[model samples]
Every structure is written in structure tokens, then in C-alpha cells.
Target: MAMAAPAMRMASSASFLPRLLPPTVFSTARAQFLVRQLSLPLFPNFNIAIPVGISLGLPSLPEVLEGIWEGILKAVPKKKTSHMKKRHRQMAGKALKDVTALCVCPACGGMKRMHYVCPTCASTHPADIFSLAPTPSTLISSSGSSSLRIHDTTSPTYPLAQTITNAHKLGCHHLATARGPQTGNIFASVGFGGDVKIWRQNPDSKEYELQWDLPTVSDAGKGDVWAIALSADENFLACTTSDGRIHVWDLAAKEKIQTYETGGGRGAAGGGGSFAMAVDLSRDGRLTASGHENGGVYVFNNDAGRMVYSLSGLAKPVRAVAFSPGCKRLAAAGNAGIIALYDMEHGEHVGNLSAPGNRPSWITSLDWNDTGDYLLSGQLDGKVKVWDVARGACVATHSETDSALWCVRWLPPTERALGPGMGKGERFCAAGASRSLSFYREATGI
Candidate 1:
């Protein structure tokens, strides 16, 4: 009994012992017949916080459903709408572009609002237009459906004068015209199949015909002729290759005259070069520039037959490159979506042009006006923006379709009777995945 009393006192003073043994029945019964008092819920509220994934594996579906239903109870729709929701709904309703009210202008026969200036000439087409070139009197456009169409921009109807069917069996990717020997009769086009064919405009009938094709260089790889740039004299044609070599062809001789290497070509992939994406010839014919898949921008002193600058601002593949009419500035764009401008004199990254709020869509084409005051850029999002070089701001933006825009070109400067209702001096042409040619004029730029 003394020993039992001592043990009971120790148990009351210490923590629970895992090896507790019950006393004999006689000793326990003789001691007391007291009943053990059961403990009710300590918190009464069983809303205990349980961590996620307490189960060794996945929980049952019914339990998951119960948790989901509990979450739903907390997210029940408000009986009274909040002001922020009302404001958002109102803004959304107003944000949609209202094109249902467009009607063709009687004077110019272009779609416009009831009483506003006719905005643009929306020409309907069948297949995606991939390239466009502007001659003195006509606009030539190409599409994937194996036809190149010529439009007479001088006329009120902009009538199609000719359609050369099956010009490219696999479709053309690029077309380039010389700057100013201004023959207005010669142009070059590069196809996806890697063939470079020259076209000549017949003065008599004003129809174009396949003039000549440059033979592939002895070591040129498959699908090598990707971009073409014609010089001002219309004598030398510069092009980029799949193997990263820039080849300049003498049109008069129909032979490749000079080859500049940035690696690639002869056993290049093992340790030599990358694909060249774009090429451009300066108006003066003194400089030639090319952009490559390695994000290299190389400006070659054509006379020196060597590279001058390998620019480095953009780390993404270069897609489009252009030299200003004066050849003082060069612009390049690519997967980075920003246009990097380089000073030709110093070969320094002078400035960058990008969209205001968001990154621009991949820039597919770039052009500068004759005076070098405005820069035209075409984007994959089917938008064409005209940027003012001096101001560094977007002067205008036009969206014609949801499809990607492949090319945009400024028409040769001309004096024409302004459309009766509008007042823009500049005319530009754009073609893209929609297979249509969209012409835009500066509502008041003349």
C-alpha cells in the first residue's frame, strides 16, 4: 500500500508514461470506484487549420469535393455589383473596334465612316501576298498561289494590268528592285526553292518576263539564295546564303563577282558559320550590309572587300535590314521586335525604335522614305506603323487583318490628283498573309 501510494504521487507529478501498468483489480477496486471523466471537445470549434497534402497519397474524391464546395461558399457572387466590375464592363464594351458602320466613299470608292475621311483601300484577295515592289508607275505584288500581279496605281480603279501565272512553283519569299539607275524595268526575286530570277519590264507592252537566273556558286549549299539586294547602278546584286556567305553577282556578266565570308560554306557547320538572314546594298554602292542568324550585323566596305562593323545590340536572329536612301544610317530588326538603328559613318548603335506599351510583333520588313524622315515597319500582327525619325514617335498605325504581314514598301514619290475627300501626300503599299495589297496614304502628309 505504501509503495502504491508513492507511485500514484509520482504519476500525478510527471508526464504520461508510455509503460504505465494498471494496479491489481483488488487494489484498484479497494482504492476507489471513481469513474474516469471523459474530456469534451477542448475547442468546441473543430475548424483546425490543416496543411495541404497531409495524406500520404491522394485524398478521396468525396473529400476533395467537400473542400471545393467550401471554397465555393466563400466565393459566392455578390448580391450587389461592385463599382470596379461595372467600370471594367463598361470599358470592355467601348474597347471593341466598331467597323460595322463602314461604307464605301462615293468619290474614291474606298471604305469609310458615314462622314469621315476614307481611311484606306481594302483590296480583297484570295491567297496570302508575300512580297511587293513599287516601280515608277506600277505596284507589283506576289503571293503563294504562284502568280505575280501588277497594278497600275495611276488609275482611279487601280486596275490589274497583268498576272504572270506560275512564276514560282513553290512561291517567292523576297523581291528587290534597284535604287536609281531608275531603269524601272529591272527587279530580282528570290524564291523559297533558292532560285534567284531577274525580271525585266518590257517598255512596249509594260509586261514583265523572266530575264535571267543566277547560277548557284560552286560551293553554295541547298536553299542558299534567301535574300537579294540590287545596287543603285543595277549592275551588282547582293544576296545572303544558307551557309552564311554574302555573294554579290554582276548582273551584266550573270556571274558572282565577289564572295565575303562570315564562316559557313566549305565545311562551315563543323566550326565555321551561321545562316545569313538579310542583305542590303547602299544607294551609293560603296557599302553592303548583311544580317545573320547569329545576330551579327556586318557592314562591308564594298570597295575594300572586307567587313567594317559587326554590330551587337540585338541578341536574336536578324530578319530585316535596310540602308537609308542617303546611306548615312542603317536599320535592322528581327525576333527581338525592336528596330536598331546604326550610324553608318561611325558604325555605332545610334538609337532604337520600339512600340510604346508592348513589345512589337516580329518585324518582317522595314523601309525609309526618300528624304529619310519617316521609317515604315511591318509587323507579324498585321499592323504597319510609320515612325518619324526626328521625333522618334509613331505617326500612324494601320491594322488590316489578323494574319501576319510579310512585306511593306513605299511607292515611288509622285505628284497626283489627291482623292477628293482626303489630304495625304505619301502613298505606301503593304502585302501579307491575307493575300491582298493594302495601300495607305498620309491623310495630310504632302
Candidate 2:
């Protein structure tokens, strides 16, 4: 009985205990069968790579390296920027020194900007240094060293405040300034080396600093360039070559706009024989006046892009031709030393601005003041004489230089003077071969 009771208790305890789990339950007999079926005994006994070759493809070492390099390169990131900063230093109201220009004379030390004052001696006496321009301040002069000078007209001693050097290699022979109600202060210069330099002032400042530079269209050389002129609005620049070619450049668009042949065979004729000598743009930018060595003056119409008039009055080599402020009259002069005023409206030789006693002695330079009331002529004998056009009289004769005067210009009246209720008249500037520039204004206060 005792054995039976213990057996029953053991059976009950076994029933209450949990069943034990097997460690290899996942290793089924079917899985083992599948693995054995997939096994390849030949490849396993030989090389594993043989089966890899059959399964995939073969590749050379170089090809593998190249592919690896391309993959690495593709995984790299690209840089988005450089080291340059966005902001820069500003130029304040600090006065710039070295603003003065020095002109050397044969006997004396350096001359001031006007060449009218001796800074070393503080002398005011005139030394007959050079014939001053009609209104000197606005007159900008250039030299062989490639520097441009602008003088102030308001002061009796016109002082230079700015200098733009390296304007061109060789030297500058011709320069022109634009005068318009909107764009009055811009100017241009041409060098013997066939390069043209255009200059403009900063609109925000009155300092008149260098603003931009234009590239040369022709190869750099002396004979390739002869003269340069700017339109009244400064939108165009016209340059003449010794080969008798005229190239018109669009300054605003910075491109070559037009070209015209002056008639030439290179080296066939003398310097002026085959090429154009001088070119001038009228006030309205509608007409272009060109003076040739053969004493031919042709007026080109900008709108028509054709020669409208060929003047026949002057037979002497026409050196300089200028249109009046109104563009109604044209003044042509040169080796003849005579100012022939023409009427563009009627295409007639209206009158002459030459004085009664003035002889034919190379009238190298001519300019009409802003008012068009006076005419300025510079002679090879270094005489700058202003003529009254209305009366055809020589109003003022200033012979300050014996050196040939190369260029002459009238400074436009200041805004204050040009404003309403102001009566300030007459101002101009003249530059010569003597390496000096002079400025002059009608002695309104003196």
C-alpha cells in the first residue's frame, strides 16, 4: 500500500513540473538534406575563386583600381566657396597729396600747375611761360608720359587736382571733352600709339577721379593713330589713323560701331597725304567734321551715316575744325592761320574769324568758348588770341609762349554761373608744345 501511495504522489509531482526544450530543434532533417544537395564537391576540393569566376565576371587589376578610384571620387564632397570677403575698405574725405603737377622750364626750377606761380620764390609776376587757355580749369591736358592733368578754372592760378598716368604708351597727341546738359564732365584722349583712353568722374563725388578704361582697337604704334574726338553726350568716341581710316567706337556699349576709309595707300603719300588728320564731333552728335592733309573738309551726317557736305573754301591743310555750341556754325583752320566759319544749315561759308593783321602762320589749334561769343586760335608762333565773332575783332591777344600751341579748349561755365540770375561770361584753356598748360577767365572780379 505504501509503495502505491508514493508512486501516485511522484506521478502528481511529474505532472506539475514543466517540460524541458531541445537545443537542436531548429536543425531539421529536411534542412540538412537541402544543404547537402546544394554542395559542390569538385569546386570545394579545388579553388573557390573558380566558382566565383563562373558566377560573376573577370576584371584586370588596372580596371579594378580605376573603378575603385572613380567610386572614391564620387563619394567626396565639393567646396561651395572661396576665401575672398564681401566688404572692402572705403576712401574717406582724406585729402590726397601729390595732386600738384610740375612743369620744367629751360632756366627756372619746377613751375606750378599754372606755370604762372613760382612756389620757391612766392612770385606773382608773369614769366611769359605759356599762353593760357581761355578757361583753364576745365581744360584737361595730356603729355608724352601718359599722364592726364585737369586744372580748376575758378582760381586765377589754375591748380591741378588729379593725374591719370600710363594713359597710353608713346604719347597723347589729341584729347577731347564732352559737354552736355546731362553728361558734361567726361573726356577722352588718344595717343600716337593708337590707343584711346576714356575718363569719367564719379557721380557721387566732385573730385573727378578716374572711372573706367577702354581697350585699344588698333595695334600699338605711332603712325596708327592720328586724332580722337568724343560726342557731346560722351556716348561715342571717334579715332583716326595715319592710314586714312576712321574708327567710331561706342563708348556706352564698349564696342566698335563704325569704320570709314579716309582714302590711302600706306607709305604711298606723306604723313597727311593718304590718312585723315583731324576729326571733330558736333554738339548734337549728328555731324562729324574731318580735316584731311589735302585741305579737304568733309562733314559726315551721323543719322545718315554718309558724307553730307564737302567744304571747298579752304585749300590749305586743314589742321583743326570745331562746331559751335549751337552746331549751326563750323570753324576750320590749320596751316593757313585763317578761321573759316561755315553755316551747316545753309552749307555756306558765312564769315571768317581771322583778325585783319593775322598772317598765315600755321593755325594749329582752334576752339569756341561755351557761349560761342568768342573764338580762340593758337598759332605755331605760340600766340593765343581770342576773337570777337560778332564784330570779327581780336579782343584779347596773350603771347605767353614762343612754343607752338598744340591744343586749345574753353572751360564750360560753372553750374553756379550757368544758373538763373548769373551773368558770368567767357572762360577757356590752352596747352602747347612747351609742356605747359594755361587757364584764363574774363577778369570778372579783378
Over 114-181, each residue of candidate 1 has an lDDT whose tens digit, in order, gives 42223353333457777887877777777766667788777544567788777777887888887552
- Highest-scoring model, lDDT: 1
Clashes of 1: 6
Tens digits of per-residue lDDT, candidate 2, 222-287, equal 246677788877788887766555678888788888766555433324433355778888888898
lDDT of prediction 2: 0.64
- Give me the displacement of residue 99 in model 1, in angstroms: 2.1
> Where in model 1 is the C-alpha error above 4 Å?
1-125, 217-223, 264-272, 421-424
Error of 2 at 4 (Å): 99
Error of 1 at 325 (Å): 0.9
